[model samples]
Target: MDIFELDSAFVLHTYARRKIAFERGENATLFDQNGDDYIDFASGIGVNSVGHGNGRLAAAIADQASKIIHSSNLYTIAIQARLAERVVRLSGLDARVFFANSGAEANEGAIKLARKYGQNSGRFEIITLRNSFHGRTIATLKATGQEKFHARFGPFPDGFVYAADTEDVLRKIGGRTAAAMVELVQGEGGVLPLDEEAVRNLAAELKKRDILLIADEVQTGVFRSGEFTASIGYSIEPDIFTLAKGLGGGVPIGAVVTTKKELFEYGDHASTFGGNFLSARAAYTVLEILEEIKNSGKLARTIGYFARKNGEISAKYPRLFLGEAGVGLMRALIAKDDLIQQAVLERAHKERVLVLRSGGSRVRMLPPLTISKEEIDLGFQRLDSACRAADF
Candidate 1:
């Protein structure tokens, strides 16, 4: 079957997907069905962390697949246990973890745990920030603060509210308040990052009130933001955090990490594919490479190079861009307006530089952690060429 045609015919029309059908990818570049090159600044929306065609990761997946692709979670999986342990160890956050299949599921698991934590206390509310996205499942959709995601979806589950500021969050805290969840850098909320000082202050208040804090790290986790998680960079230790996207390196996996080990009982939550051998092995491979990158100074070097190049892009195109909109490899060039943003996206696509349109007039880039300084420079140069060719 023709891949693109079959997808158009059979797949749900949920996404305004790009036209090109990507055939394969290498380190930081993707090749389309036409065999044209597109430097993958988007990184499959921050999922391909170590990048495409990673030999070790591929070999590990092949090796594991031959052994056993999956098994009942009823049986303790060694790979799952190891991945969870590795995540907690590297994060340096004393926490226990539960695995799931996607960020939405992870967020759902987090909400369930927080609610269960407050079940005895009679507090079950979860207040997320305005414009923050948690996930798209029913409960997670309710957890999301954007009205755009909530239209026609109501009579949503109660005990969910959105805070527009620190004061609003404080005001919302009451007898029923259970937790406040945030995305340190709001990915879909236009790639806008929350102020660290404000976040720290708010977290302190939550702690004072004995309320849990949940950091939705689906998009910003896995060294995309220069830390294992952006919450670490923020210097705020949350009660719970959700992980997905890059965790499985391309395989699907979601994890909910919590400080409270005794929050859930045996019957509280479960998943069929959660923590299965296939995804866990893939994620373990990603962690191995990321640890190497973090230790060998490549992670820092790549982030610094990206920041410097982005600074140059802004300096050269002051008229086209307003500023930068995020941190680390998960960043965006803030276009002056929607038209400018569209122009940058289209023109850059013409130059074979793949990027994404994020919330808040931003053109986002989520390059692989494995990307080199040379590839970063090449992406920016191609973007610049696109702009120049557009005579802007």
Candidate 2:
């Protein structure tokens, strides 16, 4: 059977899958069944930080799979404990962990942690910023602050307040607030970043009010934005942080890390597949590679290059591009209209380059963190051609 036919037969039509059927990938390139190569900028929607089929990642997954695919959370998994140690150490926070399988799950776990912190006081509300995105889980969907996602997902759990501005946030932070959650950069919200001053002030106010500060670092973690977490770049530490997406390279693992250890009591929450042996092993390998890159100063050097390159691109293509907003590799190239955006994406694909659209209007690029200078140039050349052809 044809690949598309096979997928259409069983899979739910939730995602608008592109026409290409990829068989394998190396670095930022994917190959179809017919051996056609395409430069990948989506990086599995920012999940594959290192890249597709990375040699180190493959060996780690294989090694762990051979030993044990999974073991329940009832017993200790040494790899999980070790990974937790590394994450907490890098996060520069006194924290414990609760792992899950996706960004949404991580956000859910964070919500629970905050709620439980104020359960006795009946303060269950979470303050979320306008245009912020958390995840697809029911609670997170309601917390997303986007009306489009809230459709048909009700009756949602209550106590989610979408603050319009810093003053609004302060006004909304009264007796019911258990936590104030935010994303320094809203990945799915057209790549719009929150005001740094606003975020800092809000965090400070939340601290003054004794409300937990939650950073949903699902899309901005694991060195995506030049830092391990975007919160670090913003210089504001959160009480509880939700992480996933790029955490385990390509492996499925999400986690909630709190500011202090013992944030959540035993039996308060749990997940069967969270922090499983295999996923933890994968996370450890990813961390090891990150540490190596950091120690070599490669991480800082690469981020510097990315920022300079982003500026150059914006200057070179002023008409085709609107502007750029990003710290490192987590960047976006704004197009004027959806029609132009669609044309560029299609033309880019024809030229064997893959890109993704954010919120139907903007083109988002999250190439592998391991993408070299040569690969970046090649992909940009192809994208430039497509963008030029798709003049608005």
Candidate 3:
């Protein structure tokens, strides 16, 4: 049976799957069943940080798999301990780590930790910014600032308040507020970065009130945002930060790093598959590659190349693209309208290029960090062709 027929017959219809089927991938390029190459600008929605078909990444997973897959959380896992140390060092916090399976789980764990930290004071409220996107769980859906995602998922967990700005956060941060979480750059919210001044001010204010600040760096962590962490750029020292997406470099893993580790006693929280040996190995290797590229200065060069190519695309098609906004490779190109946006996406696919429609008029690009400058140029040229052929 064909892929479509097989999926339609058995699989659940969660996502609107495209017609094309990719057979394999190498670095920033994917080959379809027809042996056509498509320059991947989506990178599996920012999960393939080390790139596809990476030898080291594959080898690490394979080597760990041959040894062990899951031993549950009942026993100590050395790789998980090593990965926790790695995360703490990178976070620059006197912190402890908790591993989950996805960004949503990470945020959920963080919420629990923050509430536990303030439970003695009857403070369980978490204030998130409007237009921010968290995970999709019952608690996280309520934590998400956008009301659109909250429509059908009613009767959500309580104590999540959506704020407009720092001033609102301050006003809402009475005795009931335990923490305020933010996505340094709201990836699903059209890749909008928070205002620098506002983030810094909120950090300071939260610190003064002993209210925790969590940075949801699921899309911006592991050097995906050009910096090691987006909070560093905003000068906001977050009390806790969550990592996922690129953390496993295509494998599934999630982590919540917090400075206050004593909030929870023994057996307070645990995940059956969290920080298993295989996933921990993969995550460690991804972090190792990120460190090497960052130290050698290649990461910065590649990010600059991406920004430059973004400019070239907007310049070449002034009406098609209305500039872009993001840090590093996580950018969204704002189009004229929904018609032009959808048309360009369809045309880009026709031109053997992959991009994602983030919002109604925002085309998101989250290419692999290992993508070369030459690959950026080629992707832009193909994107230009797509834009030229696109018709509203």
Candidate 4:
């Protein structure tokens, strides 16, 4: 049986699998079994920040694995300690770190921390935005605002309330509210960025009530938005934030950073594979690469160039494209219609460019930060071809 046949026979039908299967990848491109190269604009949904097959990352992982891996949290691991220090320093927050294996787990940890912190105050409810996407776990699913993710997954855990406006948020924050979690840039909800002033105002209000502010930066963290974290650009300092997608470049890793260490007791949370040596090495290497990118000013230049090209594309294809949303490399091209968006994405894939969709109608592009200007131009050309092909 071929790859598709094998997948059909054994794999669970959870995801709508794409037609192509990638075999290998290297620096902003992936090769299929047929040896066709496709420019990766999705970047594994914003996980491959350091690009594919990075030699430095691979060497670091190999070196750490050779020495030791999978040391439990019961013992002190050198690499874990080092990585945590680096994270705390770069975050510009005096916080302790708890590692997990994915974004959902990180959010879960943050939720637990918030509830524990509010335990004495009789507060357990978490207020989230109406269109925000949190995670897939039972608790995180409850924390998510969209009803589509809640289908057939009931009964969900209690204490999750969706608020649309500031008044609604304030109304929901009576005695039971423990925290208010938000995604500064709602990646899955049509690449919508929250209004900075509104977020700050809400944060200040929540603070007066002693409500914790949890920023879900799962998709927007790790310099994906040309900053280490999107919260920094927004000028809102959340009490806690969850990170995962781009932290380990391609390796599975997640983290919850909080300003207060007293929020979580020792036995409150833990993860077996969270900060193992191999993953830690990969994450540390990613941070190092990001530092280099910052110092060389490549990240800033690339982001600026992409932003200009995005504007040009929007202007060039006025009929098909409505406009652009989002910040830095994490951007989206809003289509005039959902059908046009889907058609454009399909056509782009056929033209050897891989892009993504957000909220059904926005063409999401999260190319690796290390992507070259030439590669960005190529991607834009392919997208342009797609727009022309799918023109009504």
* Backbone clash numbers for all candidates listed: 1, 0, 0, 0
Cα TM-score per model: 0.97, 0.96, 0.97, 0.98
**Model 2 TM-score, all chains together:** 0.96
The model with the greater TM-score, 1 or 2, is 1
Residue 380, model 3: Cα distance from true site in angstroms: 0.8
**lDDT per residue as tens, model 4, 40-143:** 89999999998888889889988888899887889888888999999888889988899999999999999998889889988989999898899999999988
Q: Can you write out model 1's per-residue Cα lDDT over 254-298, one digit (the tens) per residue? A: 999999888888989999999899999999999999989988888
Q: Per-residue alpha-carbon lDDT of model 2 for 7-62, expressed as tens digits?
A: 99989999888778889998888899889988888899998888888899899899
lDDT of each: 0.90, 0.84, 0.88, 0.89
Model 4 TM-score relative to the real fold: 0.98
Error of 3 at 63 (Å): 0.9
What is the lDDT ranking, best to worst? 1, 4, 3, 2
Q: Candidate 3: give the clashing pairs.
A: none
Instruction: Count residue pairs with overlapping backbones in model 1.
Output: 1
lDDT of 1 at 104: 98
TM-score of 1: 0.97
